[model samples]
Target: MHALREVGVEVPEHTLTAVTGPSGSGKSTFLQCAAGLDRPTAGVVRLGGRVISGMKERGLSRLRRTHIGFVFQSFNLLPALTVQQNVLLPLRLDGRPRDPARARELLARVGLEGREGARPGRLSGGQQQRVAIARALITEPDVVFADEPTGSLDQETGAGIMDLLREAVDRQGATVVLVTHDPSVTARADRVLRLAHGRLVQDSWAGTGTVAAGGVPRDAAAVAGGGPVR
Candidate 1:
């Protein structure tokens, strides 16, 4: 059987979408397929109106550098690079001119203003994540795919990171697709897509405060009032 079966989702621009599911339920597979990191066995994946599922590695690399951003649970910052350099890597890889001012602005926005000269290893977990957030936004990407961004942090720190992501969507007009199993995180999303056994079982939208499961509509309260689909 396919890892993902008959799954289709359309996320509007400038919105935050959360994908949640139990372990081995295809959350990461869906994320990888959607972000062009993994090719879907059969289906199309589009980004910024361009089809990306079938793109070759070189083409996918370019598209990712220029149009997509990612924040991972591990805080994947290059240890050899300073905070500023890490944040500017995407632009450099894209062959775009360096914009130190833009980098500084993003660093400041993520609360790492004066720490730009420091290496990732010199920072706390939360601080490292803040730097990662700065890096993700430095490109002003069309969409950001965050995989369990807050999973490695404590509750308070995770909340802080979530706030920064929420601000990114509200102020910077970014479209974010996040994958997580945290109910609190799901509650903060504008839309939640839940997967089960490689199938999309629920689609909940906070705007309408409703949920559709197994092709049947129901009050969101059926799932703890949008807290979590499970």
Candidate 2:
């Protein structure tokens, strides 16, 4: 059976789109395909102007390092690196000049101003997640794919993380595609895409209060006020 079948989605820039579904419903598969981590058996995946599904692994790696950002549930921090180092990793990998000032600003924005020298093991779960968030935004990526980013935190801490993501869209104009089981996260997103049996079963928009089934837009130009299609 296919992990996803005939599922099409167009996410606008500067908007937060939540992907929610039951266990084993292919939510993660959808995210993986969209983010160029997994190749779909069929169909095309595009990001900005590029067709990601056609790209080779080396090209995908470069694109991920330079234009994409990711935040995962496990924190994914290297134990040996300092908090600052973890946040600057993408820039280093892409051969960009290290901007310590920008890293400091991001750390301060995420409420980790003075903890740059500390390792991830020294911090609490919330603090570590904050560091991960700072890392995700350090590159100023055009798209961020977060899979259950707040799943490991408490209610208050999770809410705080959600606020940081919202600010990324509102302030930095970054598009966020998040996968979560949390109702609070779904409710807060600008749009929600629910999957079942490897298909898009429901699509809802918070801004317009509209819900559509099998959300294959006839004219994506009319979706979300003229953003890039796909």
Candidate 3:
């Protein structure tokens, strides 16, 4: 993308990296590449040691379905579909069967326990985002990518969403990588990686125990024996 190159954003190699900076700092560009939605100008994009950048569009789609989960800022749910349907869509797209119980569990974890039958338009902004979060985690993808996941909600709702994400990170063992201009969201992040013109400029890895495998931040190497990121 013109914006991506203009800002000099590059794909990250850290297991857990945070892309942060000013409005034009290239955080979105970094997320697009990390999520395999955008390709880098001159670097390989990998997930779980697989070279996804070289894959064909269909292959890349498959890779994303199987390995990546993305949460958007807008709560991109289909108005025509019910909450359960929207959450199950990604798994269905990959030809994976849906599990109502599992889907319900995820929604409940995000604090949307009894609203699975409601339409996106019928819910509050926070509730819609909760559906989005539930959808994002439905597949149990190896890596979860959230681009400004809490940009539009009130603090209370945002905190609920973050707790759900942290729950996934701890209970599901699924690696989470998100982007935002908000510091509150990053407080729970295992590491923080700042970006300026698209390059990694700062890394704050909490420690090996801060997060699990494949969750390293840029500029911070794996702790020996995987003890911590800090």
Candidate 4:
């Protein structure tokens, strides 16, 4: 699927950036390409100044395991593994020694401390999402790509997930690239970009009054009034 075209944008380090657009506007496609989960048909994808679009499958897999973290809407945890095991899976896959202490700390940070022994199927939607967040951070990845991480939750639960993501950036100095259509979610970002018809229509930094081509001012009133920029 040719989901995006002529899209160009740089995600600043240690910041939360949200990409907003209508359904099928290539928001997920953009995230997939940026995270090296999908290669672009044309043009290169760079992560931490390295080109990844042309990498071999084995090399790309290694790169993702080391540098990229992902949180999906579906809370993609292994159904049978305990929460602790799921969080440590990434590190194990990368041939790194498991650190039970670190795993416990992460689970605690996400408010899942006592639930470590529980499987995903036993957790609530919010708790499952929290486990996914901890798993994404297990390796201290250079960037975290969250694709509608709150899409399946209620408003209150979604807000909680957003808080955890913001904390990840503030406390862990983690870079986040988020894709969503929720205005409230976009408002939480340090920067916001809008995609329309597979093209970036706007890029603006929060509180900077700086707007890029086809971008809007990063103001709450503007976002609320404008709705989805598609």
Candidate 5:
């Protein structure tokens, strides 16, 4: 069975693009394919102008370690590692020099400065998610693919996670592709694309207008009904 079909979307550099749809609409499949976590049956997956779909698993692994970061609904932090260690895992995986200062700085940026010594088991869901965010950015990846990043958080915590993602684009120039189901979360994206039954259905710029078939902007609001883009 095909999880997705005839899907083609381009995300501009340094932008936060949100993918939204109802459950089982292939949202997560799209993210996994785009991020090179899973191979697509057809069509190419490109990152930084390079085609990744044809690359071998070893090559793809290297590409992800150096250029891509991921955040998931489960947080995915290692329970055995302290917050600081968890944040530094990416750097260590890439065989790069460990920079404790950088890890501490990221922790501080994520509002977890004093909790670095704490393990994931001892932290609240929000704090653990913050640590995950820090870990994702620790490598300063060219792109971050977040899958339901806020799905497990409370409303306020979820909002905070969104703010951090925006900061990554604005402050670090990292392109973010977020998969979410919440309209409120979609409101935060610079561009919003909706999928239905594995096909692209809506494409629009937040607070601007609907995007036409060829990616041209029409006069409609960012979302369909002129809802606040936040």
Candidate 6:
């Protein structure tokens, strides 16, 4: 993770990044801007070779619906819907046909095989998180942005969720941007990015051919110290 400073900080693409910071340090600002959920005061956000900030709402909406996936700390499931129904929300929202079979397959993939009919309120915290993951992946997005995704779970449950996210990235070639203040979550990332006082404080790259903080290397590992140059 490296912040490109033409005007303000911007994270470059194609690697796993764990974002951390104190409150109001711009972790959420960075991610929302990066994902086009919010526009920044300055800088650019590029993902999968497309610049995110300048796109029109229709285009961005299309991009988000078809190419991007987001997982929030709150599972954000429909309480009245079954596990399968909740997972299918995205597909349904897009005016697409319901595919019950595909829904069950995804639930099974996330270890929620037989719990498909249970409503969100009836599931455990970890189970709900799994449903959120399944919802994120339903569109087969290029990059999955998870914002404090495990904030409410216990250590073991959080680890399980991280395992699922990692497997999705490693096995499916999906890029991941995980935002959290937790070191444990950061440790699982192939690369880690730290932010402080509204700027990127560190870009830890941990993998073969990983580069220094300033260079955004694919398969990076974590490093501690001064932040990536901004």
Compared with the true structure, all predictions reach lDDT values of 0.80, 0.83, 0.72, 0.82, 0.82, 0.73
Clashing pairs in 5: none
Candidate 1 local lDDT, 1-230, one digit each (tens):
55777776667888888998888888888887878988876767777778898799999998889888988768789999999999999999889998999999878766678998999999998788878878888888889998888776778767877887898788989899999988889888988999898878888887565456644333332212111111
lDDT of 4 by residue, 161-216 (tens): 78878988999898999988788898899988888888777777878854654544
Give all candidate RMSDs, comma-separated.
5.6, 4.4, 6.7, 5.6, 6.0, 5.2
Better of 1 and 3 by TM-score: 1
Per-residue CA lDDT of model 2 for 1-230, tens digit only, reads: 66787777777788999999898888888888888988877677889967998899999999998889888767799999999999998899899998889989888876789999999999998788878888888898999999887887788877877888898899989999999999999989988888888777788787555456644443232222211112
> Model 2, which residues run further than 4 Å from truth?
215-230
Evaluated at residue 145, the lDDT of candidate 3 is 87
Q: Model 6: which ten-residue window has the lowest total lDDT? A: 220-229
Estimate, for each residue in 121-176, the C-alpha lDDT of model 5 and write its tens digit.
99988788788888988899999998887876778767877887898899989999
Off by over 4 Å in 6: 1-14, 95-97, 109-111, 124-126, 207-230
Candidate 5 segments whose C-alpha is farther than 4 A from its true place: 211-215, 218-230
In model 4, what is the error at residue 112, expressed in angstroms? 2.3
Clashing pairs in 2: none
- lDDT per residue as tens, model 6, 1-230: 23323223333444567888787676776676767887644555666667877888988888888878998777788899989888888888788888888888778876788998899988888789888988998877888898888886788767877877787777877778978988899878766666666655566666544333455555332222322323
lDDT of 4 at 224: 18
- Of candidate 1, the 10-residue stretch with the lowest lDDT total is 221-230
Candidate 1, residue 229: how far the Cα is off, in Å: 23
